[model samples]
Target: MEFVAKEKGFIAHFSYGDLHVSGDDEHGFRPFQLLVSSIAVCSGGVLRKILEKMRMPCSDMKVTAEVERNEEKANRVEKIHLHFVITGEQLDPEKVKKAVELARKNCPMAQSVEGSIVLTESFELVS
Candidate 1:
């Protein structure tokens, strides 16, 4: 597997194992970070959409990922913990939980990574 990224303007070419990334800024982490970001973003997006559709009116949503690395395998993230903090007004807890469950079911990224990766979810509601 190979990935290639050509410079559009500011960043240089980047190649990785089936994933490519480039940054205009110097502080970019790596391609693995991009994968984590993608998962987090996808989960958040699905949850937000589901909540909104349920009339929950999500005022704020945050997904924080804590990745556990393999000690003997050169620091590769083997498992991930996804902590979600959802803020809204007049929200039903049961509906919120259902939305999260639906989001996990419908999230493409989560489905793609489910077999090979361990993903844990915890939620908090802000009144």
Candidate 2:
């Protein structure tokens, strides 16, 4: 697997395999962005299936990540928080919580960052 990045002003063009991405950040999907994105995508995929199995059909799901860096480190993310907003009809809070727990345990991304970064999660439900 090879990845390449080219800089063009504030945006950087990135290509890897069949994936193409452009980002305003200097390094494109910087380490932190890639890390958080992994977490978001992994959890999202698992929860979608879990929700379906629980008979709670989700209409939409969005995952947002907020990372705080340590001043001393200058460029390292010290802590990260993820928010999962789920929209569906008659969603069960218990099932949602359980799904999140299961995802955290099974998601590869979450497992990958286990010892490196601090991760926290919060859930929101919208009717």
Candidate 3:
């Protein structure tokens, strides 16, 4: 991974020709948003795989991450709430709950910020 500085922000170049711009909101993605996205996407992917492995049918999934920042302390992120909406057929609430728990426990991004940030998850199933 490498980053090149532009006039307003930096462009991050990653493997596979992927590029992300990080800077002010007007220019590109903010640094904090990227952090939250990493956690959300990681957990979402894990949850999806877990559900598939358990033979749970899912047609669609969406993950939204909300963050609480402490303005007094350098505007640091204090908490992150991840809401997952899953659409499927005949979904079992108990199974979905278990998969979410497992994903939270196993997500590398969540684990990295475990001590410093409060991470919470909620899910709703649509049939």
Candidate 4:
């Protein structure tokens, strides 16, 4: 991906659209926010797939990511916690828990940050 400097930050061009990235929130999406988003979304997607493959498809899924940064270490990312809200009927919590573990292991983004950032997951089911 190529990024071009803008007045406020930089814009990266992709087939879908342009992504604005910067340190300042007003300028664009902060780098840390993007990082956390990528990990959360990747894991969520993988989890969804696993659920379907395991015959536990959900009607809807929403993922929220919470990030922890270390101030003493130049504000680097220390951990990311992902919470998933799944809406469906008769969804077994045990099976969902298994899927979560599988997702964390299969997700490329999660695996990429394995040694560096701590990744955790939780979920709640709605009928």
Kindly report which residue stretches of model 4 are placed more than 4 angstroms away from their true locations once superposed.
none
Better of 1 and 3 by TM-score: 3
Give lDDT: candidate 3, residue 96.
95
Q: Residues 1-127, candidate 2, lDDT per residue (tens digit)?
A: 4455545323333463243344446434455577678888898888888889889979999999898888787678777888899999999898899988887888888888788888888898888
Give candidate 3 regions above 4 Å deviation.
15-20
Write the number of the candidate with greater lDDT, choosing between 2 and 4. 4
Better of 2 and 3 by lDDT: 3
Against the hidden reference, what TM-scores do the models get?
0.76, 0.78, 0.92, 0.96
**Candidate 1 backbone collisions, by pair:** none
Candidate 2 TM-score over all chains jointly: 0.78
lDDT of candidates 1 onward, in order: 0.78, 0.78, 0.91, 0.94
- Evaluated at residue 8, the lDDT of candidate 2 is 34
On residues 57-107, what C-alpha lDDT tens digit does candidate 4 reach at each position?
Answer: 899999998889999999999999999999988799999999999999999
**RMSD to the hidden true structure, all candidates:** 5.6, 3.8, 1.4, 0.8
lDDT of 1 at 2: 41
Give the winner by TM-score: 1 or 2.
Answer: 2
* TM-score, structure 3 vs. true: 0.92
Residue-wise lDDT of candidate 1 within 93-124, one digit each (tens)? Answer: 88888988888899999898887778878899
Model 2, position 6: C-alpha lDDT score? 46
